[model samples]
Target: MSPSRIMSRAIVLGFLFFLSAPLLSQSLTDEAATIDQLETRLKAADKEAVTAAMTVWVDRVRSKEAELVALVEKRSSVEGDEKSRLEEQIDALRTERDALADKAMVIVKAAKAQGVDGADANEAFLSGLSTHLDLKDPNALLTFALNWIKSPQGGIKWGLNILAFFAIIIGFKILSRIAGKVVAKTMKASRMQVSDLLRDFFINTVRKTVYFIGIMMALGQIGIDIGPLLAGIGVMGFVVGFALQGTLSNFASGIMILLYRPYDIGDVVSAAGATGKVTAMSLVSTTLTTPDNQIVVIPNSSIWGGVITNITGNDTRRVDLVFGIGYDDDIGLALRVLEDIVTKHPKVLESPAPVVQLHELADSSVNFVVRPWSKTSDYWTVYWDITKEVKERFDKEGLSIPYPQQDIHLHGLPTDAA
Candidate 1:
């Protein structure tokens, strides 16, 4: 434990360390030389020879990585000069391992280019590389990214495929629009009377189908196997259909509507307890805009389940109006006035002549039913004009229009009770 004895021990240790330095340096040099030799052979070697050389190179790289790891561990426990020296050794070993890995990757790529199966060798190289990669180091990550981008099967390939995918999709999107227009024009030019709802549905369906085909083609171009995708969609559809039975019923009703042509778009329809103009139709729901501009969306099932009165479906419609004259008024004079008012209306159809007759004699008045036929679009116009003119003409002809009136009679018994 004396100072002299400690100094002597330190001198001996220093001398041993000096002797081991050259031996360690020589070992590193030998390993580097072996790696260089293997790389040279790999460059000039055929497929089988490249494979053999790659196996040896991989084993050497693994051994060097293990040594580097041990050096790092040892350095963590030491301090000052010993830690610095171990760090230097670790850096050199790491450089050598990295170069060997680069060589192995090149060899595997070359073998693959020559149609040799380097799957096992490639797998081993990746496994070893993953172990050495410092994910936290920005420089390492950047280097890995740059390398992958430059590789044939990496960023370059996928980037090109992505560009191709978008290009195909856009091209088909334009084509679908053109196809839809063409179909629409054809339907219009042809003799068949296709309803607006059905036409819209067909155009949409065609456009969607064309776009879907394009999507499938783009997926295939991007190296995606869509066979499984379609299968998955079919299964998903089945599950969704089972869950949405009510929606399915609506869909079925929509199909029936399309086939049966009960009501077309723009028709004033009374169905599902709503009276409105048919504004839009889809496979699941029908949209109606009421007279007061309120929007209503009714399920197709409800529409098809009830009575659908398409008010404007026919070309012509009948407007029925009743006018009551006072009991004392002349019935003949009131009837003549009603006939004159209806016949003077230009919108009233001449073929289906207007009928003017005494329909009923009520408690206080004689009722005359005036029926006029006109184009469906002109029906309301005729009805309003006739009602207004009838009042004016009845006054001119000295005929009185009556309202509900009750005559109260008080009996003598009531006066006696009072």
Candidate 2:
């Protein structure tokens, strides 16, 4: 309330805090030192030290629990601040005891590990073989490996099992090779409707699948449980699928492409933001060859997720050409010349009857749009041929092709009168 009294109270509180800080720090330091000593004693090979550490650990928990019980009894009697304070102390003591118990359990496990591994009677079948490493004897590894290979009875069953495993693998290898050859020959003889790339991809997939199955069988021959192995593989596959989410999506998209047949091999297509001919395809990606012979690989996810422009999908394609003629040039005459060019080209389709008209008006020229339909195979040929023919015919007829130009306007300044 009063300024002087408040100042005095603040000074007293500050002095108390200063005094308590070092005591708290020292208390923590002492606790840490005690824990370290206890851990050291528990790890020591000496029987007396270890036994004494265990006794102390048990006593510490019992003492804390007794203190908590007394505080709890006091809490039932007292009211208000005293009871709240006693309850808080009880909770703190309980937490401390729980933490101490956890630490003691860790120490006990360490003690057991130091004395004897797999010491419980129920684990007699495992013996000490379940142990991780033996730092005392480095030769234990060689001994264990030898024991696995040669049993106590000196029978060569383990040796024969190893041989059988390799034999099964080699047999599968030979079978897979023979099966692949047979599939190739059969596909060629039967004139399969699928593309060569898809055929090959399918055959190889089957062969590899067979090989994987054979390997699993080989493991079973050596007394390994195929059931648990398959379960473990399923779990591993889930994790790997998550890790390779994009790749799996590509795989799914590839399946959709194979089923839909949007663009086959040797078909020119613009897909996944690239224009190229489909050369090879797989379950994850598509291989393309550009006109310049450069190879491009695109993920099937990108192709399937976007618009696929199959340039060669249709039976015929339109070769669109535009010519900008000067305004002074004869527009009708230009259209006649374009019609002649379209008619003369052998590749142009007659049914479509090539359209030629004034398409756009510009500042300096009238743009003529010429569209000539041609077979898909002759699309590029007709485009190039029509473009070249139109240029030559326009020049012969004295038609002006206007380009971007700026006319200069010169103005003279008047002289000033004196």
lDDT of 1 by residue, 1-418 (tens): 9999999999999999777655443333243455445455445455555556455556777788788788766766787777556655655566666667765665565566677676466756645563344455465456556655765456787899999999999999999999999999999998877677788988998999999999999999898989999999999999999999999999999988987889988999999999999999988999999999999999999999999999999999999999999999887878777888888889999978889999998988899899999999998899899988987888888888887898999776634555
Off by over 4 Å in 2: 1-223, 405-418
Q: Provide the global lDDT of candidate 1 against the true structure.
A: 0.79
- Name every residue pair that clashes in candidate 2: none
Cα lDDT of model 2 by residue, 1-418, tens digit: 9999999999999999777655443332233445455455444334433434444554565576577666766766777677556655654565576555544554445445556433232122222212222334335344434543454212366577778999999999888888888888888888446666567787898789879988998999786989998999999999999999999999999878886788998899999888999988888999999989899999999999999999899898888888889888998899899989889888888987889989999777899888989899888899889888888999999998888766889899899999
lDDT of 1 at 132: 44
- Top-lDDT structure, candidate number: 1
Q: Candidate 1, which segments miss by more than 4 Å at Cα? A: 1-190, 203-228, 405-418
TM-score between model 2 and native = 0.51
Cα lDDT for residue 149, model 2? 49
Residue 282 of model 2, lDDT score: 88
Q: After superposition, how far is residue 202 of candidate 1 from its true place, in Å?
A: 2.9
Ten contiguous residues with the weakest lDDT in model 2 = 122-131
